[model samples]
Target: MVNFLQRFLVFLNIYSIFADGYSFNNDEHTENIHPFIKIGSKYYFINELLKMNWFESYNYCRSYGGELASVESHEELLALQNYILARKIESRFWFDGNDLAEEGKFVSHTTGRPLIFNKWSQNNPNNVNNEDCLEVNLYNKELLMNDINCNVENIAICKYREPNTHCSGKNSLMNQNEVCILRNLVESFAQVGHRCKSCSQAFMFPTS
Candidate 1:
């Protein structure tokens, strides 16, 4: 049972969604409920974000927080979808889990390869030989169950890696922060040069 305010907000959001060309079949849950929290400008999932297989959803969430869903079961998946739909959100979303690398190597967007629990569709992952990545189609909000080429131009999921984890030695030396500090010191010295008196030495000023 949605409260009056939550229902109202959901209505407003649905209106905006439709105005933006989103066309979704309204599910029974057409209320605005979010399983995530927004702080400052980023959104973090209240529970672990679902790890589905869609570049678009991944990118969308990344713009706000981290990867897509890491849902453990079909029940959880439906629950999430219902949660989003109730919130009046349209369009299919991406999950942050995939096995694009090795066969049976499903990995979480936040974690890495070799997931502890693996979920796959019936006869899924029939990669058909060339696929190496996965993407969830908007029309059908389900896992691709196969691999795709990473180079394909499409929405992408992004996650924040541990800060300074991937940076190398050269990268550290080229720190932009150090450069900025150095630049400020040089500018300060130049600005104060006009206030300094000439040296008392007779040769202070070059003859030239």
Candidate 2:
């Protein structure tokens, strides 16, 4: 596992350099460095302080081989919030948490997992004005989550497998957690598709 993590770190750094280059970020402030950051096992892609509607943000993340950022837990939420605040960004931003999948049920579009943790402010998520999207209220000291119109433009925060990463998105029945972890690990491999078959097997049945 240590060996694998070390390899993953190296690959992530190289990928970061590639993404920071002009050809890759032609329109989104090509000069800005640190396009993304890896925290724990997830890779987060932050825009050049640009604001876009939730739908646009989601699609943009997908185009780059990822999905909208998922603040699955309070710790994760606070960590990201601090990271943004540290940059002196006072703007509230978008993260994956919406009831679009099912009315009154907010789940991550990327993983289809129910929202388990939240920091919603008072009277937030009131679904006012037919709002169905989620955003982090940066100005709120408590880091409240709020429901807003999907079309409302806001800073886009995305996370998932990095761009240029390849995968089959296929895996046998196995530990869901491991699958998620491995999915991100092999994301950068062009041959990860067919390779996942064997790779998944190896994890299920280890050698030695």
lDDT per residue, candidate 1, 141-168, as tens digits?
5433334544444443233321242333
Q: Residues 130-203, candidate 2: write the lDDT tens digits.
A: 88998987655556788899999998888864333233446422222333534555664535445555655457
Report per-prediction Cα RMSD to one decimal: 19.3, 12.1
How does model 1 score by TM-score?
0.36
Residue 93 CA displacement from its true place in model 2, Å: 1.0
Give candidate 2 misplaced runs (Cα > 4 Å).
1-34, 39-41, 162-208
Poorest stretch of ten by lDDT in candidate 2: 172-181
Angstrom error of the Cα, residue 181, model 2: value is 14
- The TM-scores, one per candidate, come to 0.36, 0.59
lDDT of 1 at 198: 51
